[model samples]
Target: AGGQYRLFHRADLIDLLHWAARRAGVRVLLLQKVREVVPGPEPLVRLASGAELCADLVVGADGLHSVLRQALNGDEEPFFTGQVAWRAVIDNPTERRDDVTLHMAPHRHLVTYPLRQGRQLNIVAVQERAAWVGEDWRQQDDPEALRAAFADFAPDVRALLDRIETVHLWGLFRHRIAPVWHREGVALLGDALHPTLPFLAQGANMALEDGWVLAEALGRAEAIEPGLAEYRARREARVARVVRAASGNARKYHLAFPPLRWAARTGLRMAGRVAPGMMLRSFDWLYGVDVTEGSAARSRK
Candidate 1:
């Protein structure tokens, strides 16, 4: 969540993109897929719709199973994380609060947050289990499946599940970070470079961070080569750390032992009670990073 208002929404993200692109005099083409990348001093992208575009630097913002990443790194498959995510959005009638509420239960966790100015709430519930075979992100799942999975959760939480019209289920997957994010004039961005689990809720935020840093990096460079290098150097280790942390979070949130579960919840309550900003401060290193200034200072030195 970007925290633009009290809540975050997909529509808000779209609006931000629309405004930013227009201000930059950029137009985006939707529903077009890149078919191939011709790698060289200058890379050329061949689109499936028989279009060719050439750019000085090609940054792949595509999600998991990125074709650009495949062409650049010789096609690697994403490994399933042995968990499935059931996600949906329910109508938010005016009374819903604007904070994100996360409910953790045995072997599962649920996160709900308002979207569209608290007019709706997006719910994503993840469960750890076996036999989810594929990495397809758009697999359809019935709402009953969600209800059954989360039956023992809090009553208020169960009420939200009842309101879901439909649900999408997908096997969570993880990819090894590309050893190289840049090759000549091409590079990977977002999920292409590091596909993360939803455990940390940092996947989309990381992409936004990537976009912000990337645009700034490109704008600073006198040439594209150093720009790509600088971008990878600044982002690679940081994104990798977040990916690992998200994986660890999944393990922590889904502990099956009763003693462990109670301890974890109790600790969170104590921490939240002791210092609310402590949690916020722990993540300050992430949100407070100034990539442009860091890069500029490094270059000057």
Candidate 2:
């Protein structure tokens, strides 16, 4: 609540994670895709390249499409939420703005924020549609198509959309949190366990929390099984709350009734005027969470 929001490029965040892992004597393996994870008496990882590896404990941090998740909780499909999002990063010719700007309209919203020390601008534009394209994040869309979607936006927004040379569009889908977070010696961390919508921008943050809490819990537990159980117990409730909050945020942003939307906006403006930090303070339960609330020594382990 006291600190400012800092955005990170996906690559830089991963680099930092890898750096910390390596510093802690972790052997970081690259380009090795996990084909399957068998969770039982002996945890196993089968690589796509036909190599099998065994470990004491296997933590799956893989994103939306996780094979490990299927192994633990069966093949559950995610249904589209009738929303499609396009994301692109463009060079920041003007590095003056370093905050998130939201352009909200009925059934659609666009979010822009600076990244990479304001050298790059990150754009997220979401639109509600009847049909979903697909949930694959790597699916590319023509810049012209993106432009067409937001052609009616203000000139400044339109101009920024015009600057996009490349963009990826993905359908927003709702995934049920894996009923079982872990099985045997394999634990699902991050999106593998819970995939929240981008509405709150907490997908990565929650995953980071998941990793830290999982590690901290395991380090404190006497046995691997108990550690994993504790990890799941501590995270499931919190993640569910976040998932609901994110969905609710989408509803608030996509309000269709003109009067309702106007009232909501006016109320927010009045609240900001009356209690300057009221909006953010209301989210203290979220941003103020310290998952590592126990022994630091256990965390170091």
For 1-301, candidate 1 gives per-residue lDDT tens digits of: 2423245676677788889898999878889988887777888989999999998878887778787888778867677778988878789853766777788887899988888767788999999888765667678888998899999998899888999998888888878887778888888888888888878777777787787677777788888878887787778878988899899898888888999998988887787889986766676766556555665787699
Lowest lDDT sum, 10 consecutive residues, model 1, at 1-10
Q: Give TM per candidate.
A: 0.90, 0.95
In model 2, the Cα lDDT at residue 247 comes to 92
Sum up the clashes in candidate 2.
Answer: 0
**Which numbered prediction scores highest in lDDT against the true structure?**
2
TM-score of 2: 0.95
Kindly list the per-residue Cα lDDT of model 2 for residues 1-301, writing each as its tens digit.
Answer: 2557888999999899889899999997899999999988899999999999999999888989998999889989798899999999998866556688999888889999988889999999999999778889789999898899888899989989989999999999999999988888999888888998999999999998898888888887999999998888888889999999999999999899999999889988988999998987888889888776665555478
The reply for model 1, stretches above 4 Å from the true place, is 1-6, 290-301
